[model samples]
Target: MKRSIATLFILFSITIVKAQEIDSLSFIKSKRMSDDDLAKKREGTFFTGIPDFSSDPVTGFGFGLRTNTYWNGNRDNPLFPYTPYLAKLKANAAYYTSNARELVLSLDVPYYKGTRWRFKIDFKAQQNPANLYFGLTESTLGQLRLPSDENTTFSTYREFDRARKTLRPGGVGEADFVTDALSNRFRETEYMLNLKADYALGNGKWRIMGGYEIQHLSYTTFEGMEAEAIDPITGQNTTAPNGISLLRRDFEDGLISGVDGGWVSIIQTALIFDTRDFEPDPTKGYYFEIANEYSSKYIGSQFDFNKLFIQGRAYQKLPIGKRTVLAGRFGAGNIFGNNAPFFEFQDQWSPEGSINALGGRQSLRGYRANRFLARSMWFTNVELRVRLAETQIGKQRFAFAVAPFFDAGTVRDRWQDLNFKNIKTSYGGGLRIAWNQSTILSFDYGHSKEDRLFYFGIGQAF
Candidate 1:
């Protein structure tokens, strides 16, 4: 990709030429503290563990182990000036390279012991296996091109030329690998489990959330995906079953609904209104939410639905520098019953979080991650952020920032098919680190109209 974008623009111009030789001598208490007194003399427990080697265009190389623990309890309590730690923990366990696999655990205790509620918990388990199915509505965006003529079938133009190819398809002017080969027909296989919770409503900037989710799906189409054709009147070759897979032709034309595997079960709720002065990395405030979900069969859900979402976010500080900021987000969602289980219409919810929307890395960042599905959807994201340098090591406190982003969205299948038509955008840049001000480590890259991702996550991407 142009030598990985010229080696990430020469490592972002050597991090802006070593940001003043790494903040000169790493600022010795800058004339005696006051980054809020060096964050109140660095309160308490703080741990971080790394080694999570990454790469992603949806799960490529993502090795394992990631950890974070922060406590910050008493700077004379009282939620120590509005919280950013008073308890936080995260754990991750990756395993990508297409066979995808993940395990995560999280916890946050906002205003908790200091009153006005605020608590959270999250757990996840995933299994992927190439998961991805480009069909659900909006004509799956005209099947993402590449079938101009060929009356369709060479395993659907080599699986849409392995998702929009770029050479390497048997080389030279590609597209000629007949006999149904790489056809998982848009792939399929997923296993999931999610658990969530949140509570705080009485001036902890309103909150109330709940959750329990489940998923189990599988589909393969037909062993090695047959394809032979030419039997109009039995004069020769025969085999084709429409060469299978669009999740087995939407489960044999029923237009999807648990294709051969089951377990859906869900229940969730939300109503939030955070004022983000710092929910890890906010610079200013205003966050809003409204979520709802349910799946019955009397809650052991084998399918039956209800969903709703609404979101908003904002942050601002940009008066030109000294740590500029400007953030934005917007959302919308829908899915009212009548059998919800086409992977639950590509998720979207909030209580402060939930995603999988118009596309990847937290919504449209260079697409491809649940790349659009339907039943209703909407999205937006904007960014600015700036802060070039800061340092300190012993008590750990580092800072560096730069963001530049934009994203857009669209989707539908109902909810009267909304009508923002097509949409789908991306543009980006990012880099942030601020370890001991409460862990953040992003890295973004974006750029879409069909992909150009690069993300290393931790937070922000709100």
Candidate 2:
């Protein structure tokens, strides 16, 4: 898998170089065109298509297509300015062969009607036929009891070793035992609809935002697995009764029995202050936001929770070069009310919808999605982006960049228990490609104490 990923990256780099060369030759050939002709050709919608390649522990290497369309909503009104009121639509879909499938569609209408208001709507549907789970909370390792006794605390690697050492008298070894006993992989289907509106304040640097979200989530265990049981007398592993599965055992143990599948309706509001020069790839300025969310039976929600979130980001253009920039973000979230649903603990439900509490590609890139969950969490990310190249292909503009970043975060069962030493950290670098300053393609590689991960996605992590 590593070799394949390396080869794919090499091919991608070669393709980028070739495309630059081709653009250069095309520019030379177009020198005969008058400036007026070039200006006349630039007044239409621009479309960009890019091949997507992404991999993670959950979905392996997946290939797909991502398409973006950008146009000025005031295209017909020649007197109107071109930017700050632009419209964008994005559609992306990916399939991990036999592993998983995802589709996302979103539209953004900024500065509608020359007013301060902006609107955005997004719909996402995903089917993960086999998604991984490492139990829940701090009990995941203790529940396995593989590498040592129930009370022993050891690294994940050590746990695997212990599992091997204690293979049942006639049972499978550690690897196979973990794969069977802890298949942890299950099928999950999720559909989300998000709608948001923002109204700018006095200077257009601050804004008030409101949004509603409807989510439907369901899960089922993967098939074709033999259930395991422990022999009461010998402590050996053996096959369980017919119709039993690892997922069933978890349900019987009451791990995720609550809030497994349900409808979650959320109403959210936020106050935002943004001075960034560009939304997709900000060069300079500060962005800060505070948000509140309410979900309850009164609001047509199956579960109830009130969440408070706050986040801030800073982007500085370095004097080292025209293209060097430094960007950093800090954010935290806490859930209130009784019996918060496990699904709501996800990093996606907070202020701006872009900032995650922790884990996943958006926050801790080296960790798995929803790797950590608690009532409250905080995270920070810093990156230094350096532009490697910029050029024009036909009438479209393109820029390539490389960014090295650091991420650290931690989750706590209670807000007051937050501690810095518990923070999980990761360091990584990323490759970014921008088109027309509106659309971005990203490839990042991150390493953490537990694992190393590679992710390919759209837009900035923050």
Candidate 3:
């Protein structure tokens, strides 16, 4: 039996309950930007689009190219009186085709010197669709972010964001200087390969998703694994649990840790779904997803984590008004394992970091980046979208949409901690300009008792 754990899927199952009802423009955006990018849209969240991988399935030939830029510099920081621009560029495109025998080729190119590029192909047979489905997803990934004399930060994970969240004034701003290379830079550049397969059981309307991916994680970053661990209990942190304090965690965004060395291995079976049985409208429907995926760092990678997750989404047309629609829902999940991986965020309200509001595009709309990364958490949202304008764009009609929504949720606590009797809530509205049958540009602002924020994104929050 594979030694892999079931943490990922386990949490997936529990959260399986939550859902999304993606509509028109936003629907397409969610698919393109993907769960990963949507999540990154949140402040303080890790820029996991690092490898720029697409979680959606692929079976045909198509090429896509995207370039992303990140410019961040504070005017108040004394590190360098002059605010400098921190720029990042990422672009990717892929093509794929298949033969009856299950053969495919995929080429991915990413130019940003801070990420990775990949090419993938697969071959297998659908011997028995009745009870077994076997296939392969093989991939080769190369480095895009190579180290340069001017570039020094090794790991750009949330850990760095939290550490840099606050600036302490000493005799000179030089106090926050990077004297050690490993602790300051993300410098590894390497290649990797991954293989995967899946099988599922049907339970009437619901078909559980379970599969595995074998991965080879061999890359370098400016930082090392021994850096520091964000205190889940007290946002305050120490570099070495017993020796030194590395960088302080930032509660506004979220916190993340860094790792070094490389390991490759097979992840255990997880879950997935084919919501066709639940809804028919490809643009607006009701369905859910759950997973308990698990994998090791590298083949011989040091620490391993097991994770569990579950989520659900649904939508329908309402008679409230013209071009008016109602869609949205709630989601909850948990993580458990010897060393389960988690999204970290220094909670300003809590100080210490425990898995709480892993804020992302999917969870909290007004927050900036991983406003609150959490290991154990709950996320919820309710939206009513309406299309006001109708015009043709190219081969498709364009639409202007407005959605009034209420979002309420919390993290780290069990259901009991959340009082259905009384909950923390936020209200907001947004506008969207849609093109063709596929794209959208949205601006949503939400306000709550804690904070009020604005969100400008490519697609829908569903």
Task: Give the TM-score of each candidate.
Answer: 0.30, 0.77, 0.48
lDDT of 3 by residue, 1-462 (tens): 224345444455345434322121221112222232222122211121222122111122323333333332343322111111123333333322321111122222211121111122222221110110000000000111111111323232333345432222212222432222122222222233333332222222233333343332222332223444344357665442111112111111233232233442434434434332112112345556554444555534444554445556677667665546677766665544333322212211110001224333446654433333334455678888887877754433456788888876555433334335334456788787654323455667776544456665444666
TM-score winner: 2
Show where candidate 3 strays beyond 4 Å. 1-205, 211-284, 297-301, 341-357, 413-424
lDDT of 2 at 388: 88
Q: Candidate 2 deviates by what RMSD?
A: 12.9
- Residue 63 shift from truth in candidate 2, angstroms: 2.1
Computed on alpha carbons, the lDDT of every model, listed in order, comes to 0.65, 0.66, 0.37
Error of 3 at 365 (Å): 1.2
Model 1 C-alpha lDDT per residue in residues 39-155, reported as the tens digit of each score: 544677778877787677766778888898888776775456566677878888988776677888888776566544456677666666565666777666544543223243322
lDDT of 1 at 97: 78
* Model 2: colliding residue pairs: 147-162
Q: Candidate 2, residues 1-462: lDDT per residue as tens digits?
A: 312322343354344334432111221121122232223333457787887786665577888998988774433553122243267788999988646899999898876755556899999999986554544453331323332133544455334433433323322222233223334456779899999887655556666677788989897763334545455457676663222234455566675444367888887777778776566677677888877777778778887777777889998878876578899998887877656665566654544455544566889887766666667788899999999888887778778999999999887777887678567888999999877666777889988766678888778886
List the lowest-lDDT window of 10 residues for candidate 2.
22-31
